[model samples]
Target chain A: MKPRGWKELNPGAVITEAGSARKFKTGSWRSFKPVWIEENCIQCMMCWIYCPDMAITAKDGKRGEFNYYFCKGCGICALECPGKKGKKAIVMEEEGQ
Target chain B: MSASRVVAVTGNESVAEALRQVNPDVSAAYPITPATDIMQRFTHYVSNGKVKTEMILVESEHSAMSACIGASAAGGRVMTATSSQGLALMWEELFIASGYRLPIVMSLVNRALSAPINIHCDHSDGMGARDCGWIQLWSENAQEAYDNTIQAFRIAENMDIRLPAMVCMDGFIISHSIERMEYLDDDAVRNYVGDFKQLYPLLDIAHPVSYGPLILSDYYMEYKRAHAEVMSKVKHVVLDAASEFERISGRKYGLFEDYRLDDAEIGLVVLNSAAGTSKDVVDAFRDRGIKAGLLKPRLFRPFPYEEVGEALKHLKAVCVLDRADASGASYGPLFMEIASSVSPYSPRPVLLNKIYGLGGRDYLPGHAESVLSELAEVAATGKVRTFKEYIGVRE
Candidate 1:
């Protein structure tokens, strides 16, 4: 969609379209990234329930993937992930490392 | 024309009756002096099942205005009422209400702002909120208060001018005093102020919309400009609503009322209940062959600048009376607006500012006569001894 001019703006400064916030790429703001390890994963979906940005994606009632398009990499999902023994299901790493 | 019923009611009751007739979807208000009677009477209607409005008795004026904003944003017709301190408490939400373009109607019983705490009639409360972005309507008497309250919903809800509106009447002078006022039938009022239709309702999940977005420097100016554009269009909306109201009730209304202004050399500009007293003095002056006239402004927000300029251009001199003090400014708020409006004329009329009735001082007809006499001297000698004077003050 084309950007609106001052005259074309809404009366209440409203964004009329649903889910328009998806157009803004916020992942670029992250210096660290969350990487998921499927091997040490339990399908508890704790991270899915706790992600503030709705960045965690679930598939077929099981934990699936992270939508990096919006994830700011605050690491809440990794911190809340319940994994086996000493192995973590998710971990935050420096971007481009 | 529909037959009207006349009832003796106070200004507060008139507003409450209008609210009952409109029967908005929601109302959230707190009790405050001068304005308390309005919400109190409306609460009775709610308890008696007279209307289907959902009444929310909020904890504070801030919460009252906040609840109204929430209801209005969700596409519900909403209203509230407040006075001096109550209005001051709702200051923050007042901006949010207008910024979101919610068409919430409010009845503001004008009273003096407090340091010593006095509850009486004055313009201080309403005048203090001039820049809050809501359209303001000043009522002279009980009838005008009732009519303005009904007209306010239509004006605020107009698609081109979707902004919150306030119907203001002098606190004790009009709000407590009983007067004979004719009221339109309930069906007429309901039909005139039709259903509430919103362009972007928060409750419409099928077609969702986001309101009050956080806009940075990239788009904040554009959003403000849009709000300003809508405010500029309010004047025409108010006029259209007034004309439609006139058709049903047989009462004519305009942006400002010019009483005997034609062929007058001296003019007095005032507002609210004081205009009633000034009109009587104008008649007395006319009997003695003095060309005195009164200009009472009904719409104060989108002030009829061009019309006011044209009205005062022919007069030799004009005195602008203000019930609120601007404190430290050369002229009061009303006087400054009047001066700016008439400054473009080739031969501008000599203008004087008379700050009076502050903190609910009694403004009698004799006080108006004294100001007119001063204006007559200015008109004759073509010299203003002082640009501003305090009327009725001992020292």
Candidate 2:
């Protein structure tokens, strides 16, 4: 993005509008991505409660997929996921793979 | 103008009187030598209900400045006081306060930094923070110190130039020595400084604003550029405030004060209390038929370069004295500034630098006489001697 010139910047770099933090995308910082396997899932909503970035998408009390735009790939969701036996619902994978 | 009382008090007492009259909303301070008296006296007013200021006695100078930043962001008139090491300790917060555009005022009692473990008057402390984006007003004595303290409020709080300012006075010399000064009535000072109008105050909850936000590389330079642009407007604001202050108290001020410099062939540039001593020597040289004058810079940061250049360009020889040494740079800070300002003019004056009075050594009148004599000789012969030399140091 072409940066704004000095004249356009606000005095003291103050952000006048609230919640401007949403404009920045932090997901690109991740080296690993969280992969959700719905086949082994038991919709416990634990990932939603454990996700630090609020990147877990949900609707009407049901667990959904990850919002990659904001997720940092912390693997917290995969760690918190309670799935059947040795098969976890959420797993971490290298971003490129 | 209202009636003001004449009082004999030390610089710290006079500054405390000014703070008492203006009665800022918050003052967060930590005690240090030479400047401890200013804050200590102010706290008495806070205790006796002489002024309604919230005094936060912090653990260190760093925390004092931190509390000042928080209080100022919350939209209150804030002030503080410190000396040498204390000022050094608050170094990071100095940039933060100015960068955030907080109109905080500080009374900087100039003292030497530690290492020799000294507590004495010198310009090292204030000179060290010269580039921190705060407006610096140098005062010659108790009277000027008190006047500058009162004027800093109006200048810093100016909406067009919302930057922090420091009113600097020599430690022990002006800070501790008793001098006679005038005090404007409390009502006059109140009416003069008026009220602080906060810009994007954090306390204005209905209209939310975030300060010191995380600005990445893409926008950080632009923000700094904008900050530099604001400083370009401070010179005008300082003058306007001085004029307003003149109305309340009949003392006039300017970016720099010229003493007998009109058509002067020999000149000297000095700062703070040394200027007071240099003026008498200038008169002595005048009596001896050597055309001598002096220029004492009142506004050091965002220096009045063009005006200074114009003032010194006519002289055949000019000497710049620095109370603090810019070690390894060879030339003193003031000399470098004067050299740069006058670089463009044809027939530029012969500029010399003399490092003097470090660690509170006495600035004697004889020292000024010798420097002026050198200027006289260089002007007459049109030849140069050593360009930079340290004065008052034992060989």
Candidate 3:
């Protein structure tokens, strides 16, 4: 209903150039976040390689973990992964997109 | 990288092959000359079922981008291509693509933006879209054309990087040139690009999510704030994709690249196919003991501000060459962005704006010599100018 902008609460946007912080445009969470299904992931490591932000993570020794720290929540992996649908292991959820 | 082995696909065909590589679900287009060939290739793919995607032929470029936003919102990988007046027509939907953060990837043929009207190549068409919040990339050749299209999808589709991108290549030259290009095999491209699953598909009847909701002033600034935040994702996306594209294509590149500039004191900023010409000129300059080098722009829209500024930081004279004129401004749009990038820094190098190749005017060897001569003058004068003479123009 309203536009997204900078806030004291969120990390907000980065100051690309010099000068004081400009007015906030929108709060991020407007984008989307991706959720991963642990059981279905075969840990092919494709998500990490193809991830533009390198947002995917691996578990300690066990492997197959995604920190989702910087994940915009694009479901490319979940949708393309063999485990999708009845066995969708990685699903996209709405967050600070 | 060896230029001899380069493939000779037209700019439009590059878009068609790029569509196959990017692998979108819904493709639409309203063709213009030079750019029409792009939709042609896409049509063949759709008919042959090689791409396995919907090829929607729209009535106009405006509807093409709007339909793209809808398709992207509905969670389909989408693509389109246009040039000159067609791009001018799509201006409104261009902003809509960014506002909705649809991450739509379109191809611009880098034709001269019309007034007196020319079908030839220039930055006017692409520069007009500068403030639209889409990532812009210019290709030196058809390979970069193919390469940027795939990386554009990777950049636009990333959540933090969910903005649109216009992968620009010269309309007639690179678009029409027939060279030997190593086309990426479908499976390998599929493996490299993976699939574009939408962040949250708007069409899912069960899970209703918001997209381009009405934004009052309060919230409007915030989404724009996030838009700024999302561009940071570009540094990562470009680097990551460039690395892989290089591995496959074997010609490594960055957002902005320096040719013969490693130790040169003179900097010439340029974009598109002109970079190839500039490289030869730089060699001739070096033979004459003039250290003039080139700062070729790879990514125009995101502006690649930091890389460009840093590259020119050590130069004695930084000549900003613009292919498109910005009417009343200091010079062309690219020159302005360069000047502003180094605006705050003191003892800044000199910036000279040289407008060349309007209405498809050619920048030949004699023109290159004159450009270098002017650089010699600026290096000797130390005066910072917002404008300079047009190179190789007829009286």
Best-matching candidate per lDDT? 2
Compute the lDDT of residue B25 as modeled in candidate 3: 91
Best-matching candidate per TM-score: 2
Clashes of 2: 0
Candidate 1: which stretches are off by over 4 Å?
Answer: A31-44, A60-65, A82-84, A87-97
Candidate 3 residue-wise lDDT, B1-395, digit = tens: 21223355665676688787666899878989778888888888789887778888889989998899889888898888899999999999898887677778888888887677789888788888888888988888887788788778877777666778889988787888865666766666676677787766777756655555455675567767767766666777888878877776676878888888878778788888877788888898899898888888887767777777777777777777788888887577888888988776777777788888876788776666667677777788865454576766768
Estimate every model's Cα lDDT from 0 to 1. 0.92, 0.92, 0.75
Candidate 3 per-residue C-alpha lDDT over A1-97 given as tens digits, one digit per residue, 9 for 90 to 100: 4533354312212222332222333223226666777788766666666665546665553335565445555667666666634686667766634
Query: Compared with the real two-chain complex, what DockQ does model 1 have?
Result: 0.74
Query: Which ranking of candidates, highest TM-score first?
Result: 2, 1, 3
**lDDT, candidate 1, B1-395, per-residue tens:** 67789999999999999999999999999999999999999999999999899999989999999999999999899999999999999999999999999999999999999987989978888988888999999999999999999999999999888999999999989999999999999999999999999878899998889988888898888888887778788889989999999999999999899999989999999999999999999999999999999999999997878988998899999999999888787889999889998999979889998889987899998998988998889999998788888888997
For candidate 3 chain B, the 10 contiguous residues with the lowest summed lDDT are B1-10
Off by over 4 Å in 3: A1-97, B1-7, B381-386
Error of 2 at B120 (Å): 0.4
Which candidate wins on DockQ? 2
lDDT of 3: 0.75
Tens-place lDDT digits, model 2, residues A3-58: 67888877778889998777768898899999999989888889999999868889
